[model samples]
Target: MAMTKKIPDTIKGANTFCPGCGHGVVVRLIAEALEELGHADDAICAVAVGCSCLVNVALGIDKIGCPHGRASACAAGIKRVRPGNLVFSYQGDGDSLSIGLAETVYSAQRNEKFTQIIVNNGVFGMTGGQASPCTLIGQKTTTTVDGRSVNMSGVPLDIMKMFGQIESVAYLARGSVHDAQNILNTKRYIKKAFEAQMAGAGFSCVEILSPCPTNWHMEPVDSMERIAGVVSAYYPIGEIVTGGGLNA
Candidate 1:
């Protein structure tokens, strides 16, 4: 009989993210997936500024820090220079949807051969909880003290739909880590995104609806509930693309 192998010792340390922070969970999932797929050694992760900036410490993977919002461009450059390596980027909502919007859109437009993980925590957790591009309508943040108003702050950007419109994007999906089921689904999406990259299909982006307990001024458990009830309601979870299952 064959024996089930254990996860690598490299991923045993305490994560840097705060309690109820979804980044740590997602990072572990990605790391497990990489190990399972035997790409752990060849994977190169690029982390952007914001909450996800210190991804290197969380995941025992080869990681590089990119500029404030240039994770996608940096990932593209790495992939272009080292086509054999599995390249990915870990970015937060502020990093990817705000300052990094141009790079994200252009990379998808060009079908860059890489995978991007966008953690949409709604608020900027690392920088005083400012309202982010993915912040839900009527949600309150440091910048939106009285709830986000459409008149003041345009509608939240539906990044999945926006990138789905780009012909070059091969795989796009939105998932959440607010619940056990959604967490499983998020892992599935991450695996698919990695597979898409390995198959050289095109760009793949997985948007993860995460929680920021500290920013929300709520306890960890309450923050998770908020993500499930409010966050998921606004940003429904599911896959937007599959690259025609070419990667499978």
Candidate 2:
């Protein structure tokens, strides 16, 4: 029998994301992963400030709103206390890679047993299109109106590269949601990240390259194509790590 798509009960209310925003897709994928892992009723989500805050209302699971860039710390505490529950943190580039960089790095250093899903749209979508740590050189944002300059900003951070160096990081992957096939593949990566946590393999994170049509001042379709043509070029897509134990 053919399979039908289903939205887990964890998600409720209108998605409310803009036409081409990838947050909605990422949220749905996370919900599906939790349900598939039988964590629908047992998952705790720590959401950071920014657009990620919406996940609390969108996903019916127990959720805690963490201070900006502090979701990782919050998730770590929740996981320790709830040890038996599935714990994950949802954050955006601005919140996770910029303001929350320290929290993120140390959590991996300690091998926190939880999943961290970062939406890397490169721009600060919630606070106008400002350049974020993941914003590419030559990319234009409100702060970098002309274009990002390496001399001034250094370089776009390759978070996976940093996490890959940490001994505690059991799984690290980058995925995109620009097309149907990639979306499905991203879901696979997300699921594996969760599975790694369940196996007690340590810190796991899935960084998803998403599109921001509204912020990019492009039509929705154009934004999707841009992600295919430009964004993915720097970020790339694939499982960078799958834990030493879980093959592929």
Top lDDT: which candidate number? 2
lDDT of each: 0.87, 0.88
Residue-by-residue lDDT tens digits, candidate 1, 21-72: 8888888789888987789899998899988976777778789999988999
- Report how far off residue 199 is in candidate 2 (Å): 1.0
lDDT minimum window of 10 residues, candidate 1: 239-248
Off by over 4 Å in 2: 1-5, 245-248
Which 10 residues in a row give candidate 2 its minimum summed lDDT?
Answer: 239-248
TM-score of each: 0.94, 0.96
Error of 2 at 102 (Å): 0.3
RMSD of 1: 2.1
**Model 1 C-alpha lDDT versus the unseen true structure:** 0.87
Best by TM-score: 2
